[model samples]
Target: MKAKVGMEVSWHLRMLLFISFASSFLNVSYAQTNNDYDTPAAPPPGLSNCNGVFLTYSFTSRDKEYPHIKNATAQAWAFKSSATIVNTGEYEVKAWQMFVGFQHKETLVSATGATIVDSDDFPVDASNGTTFAGGSQADLKTSIETAGDFTQISAQIDITGTQFGVKPPGVPMPSIIKLVNNGYKCPKATMRGSYNY
Candidate 1:
């Protein structure tokens, strides 16, 4: 009787240990799976925003006057950007200014197969060379009276450079544009200065 009782108690302890170990293993596996599923996705390149204002900018180079202006030492290039500003708050955005900064890079190859890289930064301004502004007090009040109201904005920068010349192979021009608002009202904020290209 004593031997049978001892065997029964040993079996019960063994079963309890097995159950505890299995429960711990299951919890660890579940934690790993949950973490894997909670990871976030990466954002797209060259897409950024500022205070509910989202901007999408891109750079492309081509010989607009190609073939027609054969043997031309230089070419014209265009840079463009657009934004969508949304009013998510109750207050209206009266008199808003959007400033864009650009960094231009040119990779030049000489007739002798020599290569040179040059870069410069400049601001995208209006025809009067002032920071781009929009939405008067009245316009803002009318347009953004309700939440979820939004407005569209755009900017362009045109430039001419010898780096666009096709005489030397592998010569190309590229640009990097960004928003330059130091978190202030109009006239106080300024974009990057112009470059000679």
Candidate 2:
């Protein structure tokens, strides 16, 4: 009789533990699934609603290299990417500033055709967000009357981090890309298959 009671008590304890674990797991899953940034909301109405300026980001390659940080490992992944901003509007865009919302804990290595505003620090901490503006050719003219590459600005950027996904929808992308200019707005970025320029 005593043995039977002990067995029953042990079984009940095991069941209780299993239920607690399952509840915790379900709570974690629910929290992760309820992320608001998973699908960004549509841009607000009014104030230059037209999508005249287009931005495209391309993941070039990933390389493993030894970083020169203080307490870093012998190897780390470096990401190479490129972005293009084309102004197809009727008027010229002067001193264009763009906001980049990089989610990974990345440290910028190099960038061309633009510079981070208000920061001379190399390898800028772009983990949260940063702004990039034109360096020399700050004005992006309209493409309506342009013949060559006068209506666009292309940038090449490199960073080092240990984030996953190198291609397609799995690739790490900025949560938001907005034209910081007063009268211009930008839509969310879209993913595209690998293609050469």
Candidate 3:
């Protein structure tokens, strides 16, 4: 008779615990509904918003190499701006990294002004705390970052000298930005930036 009584008490306690959990979840959902009211509409097709972010580029590159695109264009989409505006404000619109250009034998060209010839794929480390959803801008940046940059032409490359260690790969010629930026009025050649995410 005592064991039966104990079991009944245990069952009641379990039922009470379940009811408590359900009530807690319900209150949380109710509270969050208030926060949702102030949230802006999801970013429109092009003119959009990142969650909790009014407007901003996760990363920006103001390289010294490509003078033309250096600080040429920014990447924050303005609110109420055109949906087609992927980049805006003040930013440098240099060519895409070479390895992201003609170098990678396969894969669609990244964007307009991208250098496809010397492009190479750079795999990001998911375990290294850099998170990237496939096809996101972050993914594209990874590909560009892995590509060797076009700067500081080593003497060994110019003369095939012994100083060249194992003949580090050379940046491709006819690269859209490097060539143009190099000869631009201010004469900048290559520029690069990295995103921590």
Which candidate achieves the best lDDT against the true structure? 2
RMSD of each: 15.0, 16.9, 18.7
Of the candidates shown, which would achieve the greatest TM-score relative to the real structure?
2
Write one digit per residue (lDDT tens) for candidate 3, span 1-197.
99999999999999999999999999988998877677764432322222211111112211122222323222111111000112221222233111111121212212222212322433221111111111222111121333422121100000000011111132212121122122223122232221110
Ranking by lDDT: 2, 1, 3
Q: What tens-digit string does per-residue lDDT give for candidate 2 at 1-197?
A: 99999999999999999999999999999989997868753422221344476665555666645543343332345777665566756777788887777675666767787788847967677878778888776878775656535425233333333433332234556677677899864555555453211
Worst 10 residues of 2 by lDDT: 41-50
Q: lDDT scores for all predictions? A: 0.35, 0.63, 0.25
| TM-score of structure candidate 3 | 0.21
**What TM-score would candidate 2 get against the native?**
0.58
1 versus 2: better TM-score goes to: 2
Looking at model 2, the pairs that clash are: none
Which regions in candidate 2 have their CA more than 4 angstroms from the true location?
1-51, 66-75, 148-170, 194-197
lDDT minimum window of 10 residues, candidate 1? 110-119
Task: Give lDDT tens digits, candidate 1, residues 1-197.
Answer: 99999999999999999999999999988998896668753432322423333333222344453344554444533322232222333344454443333223332221111111121223222222222334232123322454333332222222323233443333332232223344533222212222111
